[model samples]
Target: MGLQNITGLFYPSQTLGGPHIDIEDIITSQNVISRVMHSYLGILVPLGLLAGVICVAILIRNKVKHQTLENLDLHLLALVATDITIVFYSFTSKTRPDYLEVSNLSCGVLSWFFNTSYFFSQYLLVLMILILLILDDSKTSQSHLRYVFLTLTLSIVMSVVNVSLLGTYDNLHNITYCQLDPLNARPEYDFTKFFAGFCVPSLVLLIFVILIIIRAREVEMSEKLQAHGVVLCHVPIMFICRLFYNIMLIRRTGLKINAFYMSPREELVLNIAELAVFSGSCIGLIITLALHKPCRQGLKKSLQFLINKCRGKETSNSVI
Candidate 1:
């Protein structure tokens, strides 16, 4: 898709070694690129699905046999699992056979799961980090309860607002299955609504995450575990990704294809955001599981068993 988007965006006039592709004639070129990219996706789908299955097996086993995860963190795991599913499905998504168009429902469902998990996970993570960062207080349980409720309430409100403001999940880019509906690109677009609903909230979360990181660093721990660093890394990744994505979303009116369509500056930010998003979930899992001895050991063992089973199945299939 990135390659195709680039080919479309940079339509040079004359060919030095190849054909001329001037930026003026974009629509025709874009259609050509889109068709080629769509065909390429047919080959990419099988590999993507295989990888998704492996990732799902790992997450499922980790969820089932996790011994050291705090009871409160189950929701966190659920969010993480859902994220994997969302991305995996989105990556392997295909077009319908009849009209050569992707199913809006599949794309929408994946997008919904991804976005909903994102907000709620951050909501939970921020609360957890706050509790850990701040000094001891007597009403920890009550305060924690309130925090959970507040986060849930906020999630619900934001979701409703998103549906109302951004239109339903049906609004998606045809080529990139994972892209978000830009607020500015909506039917009755309002810049204020866009900034307030998505942009401002992300900025606020970033500020809070920074403060938490600073406070956490200042305090000395009895155990001196490096887990704090791992946790801190997770929040910043989310903040950075949200910030990068939202900003580019406003800065560009063209399209969100790939690195090619972007200005040099936009390109840099896009790369960073993509990396942060990709690393956010898996790295967080690695950190959380690796930080605790029991979880680290248990997950490693479970993964080994799963891998062995997959290999056995592959062998059986090959024989048959």
Candidate 2:
């Protein structure tokens, strides 16, 4: 369907290069829209890495202090790990101007990792929601272990299959980046992609939201406005951004074939959608830091410790 095609949500085509791409045009002829997309990616890469680093530090400190993983922290750490991979792949793809020009095993593998990490992140969130719904604090640690094992095992298997079936970037789609070809996509491809990538997670998330509302109504749980709910609720924003981006891609392709055929107006709208995807990903981590009380408290301690260390150093210097 035209709508599906616009989403740019499916796997890459198995075929290699279609038409001869002019590298010069890609580099020199990028309009303002393409440049803005490039800029968004450039910023997102670093922002994602910073989020990962902050989370890692907090996780480690908590582990050392408590001598065991806390329920919320363990799940959050899993998310941070996935966020690192997603960020790394985004950084690599965005930083290299020649990413599309190169077709090597490493490049293909990186593409595979990017897709896998995204899927794993979504799956992990679904798992976390289930944990919150099903288990109390006592069983959460055990559940987290099982969740991690399952998510990792499934992520590896599905990513390998996705790459094997779909292949990798065939050509430089545009100045901003290249991606899987929608033209060569099969019907089965869309089903598998939609099921794993969108459908299951969305359904689970909706159910999770409904459950939260019901629980709030039944029991006036004052703690409902706390960190966990805030962090979990923020996930839907990412999903909505991704959904819109794919829809726009469908719209763009319906209008014309590729970036080469994109009008300035169409290109601008496409870039705007692209920015939403980037922003949504970054916002997840930001929300974690902002709303997750444990992470916030750890950050506060870490900051105060640094300040004390600085003061001690200054005192020693004066004494000397």
lDDT for each residue of candidate 2 in 78-164, tens digit (9 for 90 to 100) = 877776665554444342222243333344455467667767888888777766655456675777688788987887777666565
lDDT by residue (tens digit), candidate 1, 1-320: 12112123321211111233334353344354345435435543344344334444554565567633332344344445544543453333233111122334344444445556556666666665554555333454445556667876776566545445443334344332224332123432223334644566566566766665555445353222244454455566566655665565555534423323443334334333433444455445545555544445655787899999999999999999
State every prediction's TM-score relative to the real structure.
0.54, 0.74
For model 2, what is the alpha-carbon lDDT of residue 45? 57
Worst 10 residues of 1 by lDDT: 9-18
Determine the C-alpha RMSD for candidate 2 after optimal superposition of all C-alphas: 6.7
Candidate number of the best lDDT: 2
* Model 1 pairs in collision: 11-21, 11-22, 12-21, 12-22
Off by over 4 Å in 1: 1-72, 92-113, 135-150, 167-179, 182-184, 187-227, 253-279, 301-320
Q: What are the candidates' C-alpha RMSDs?
A: 9.2, 6.7
Instruction: Give the top-scoring candidate (TM-score).
Output: 2
lDDT of each: 0.46, 0.60
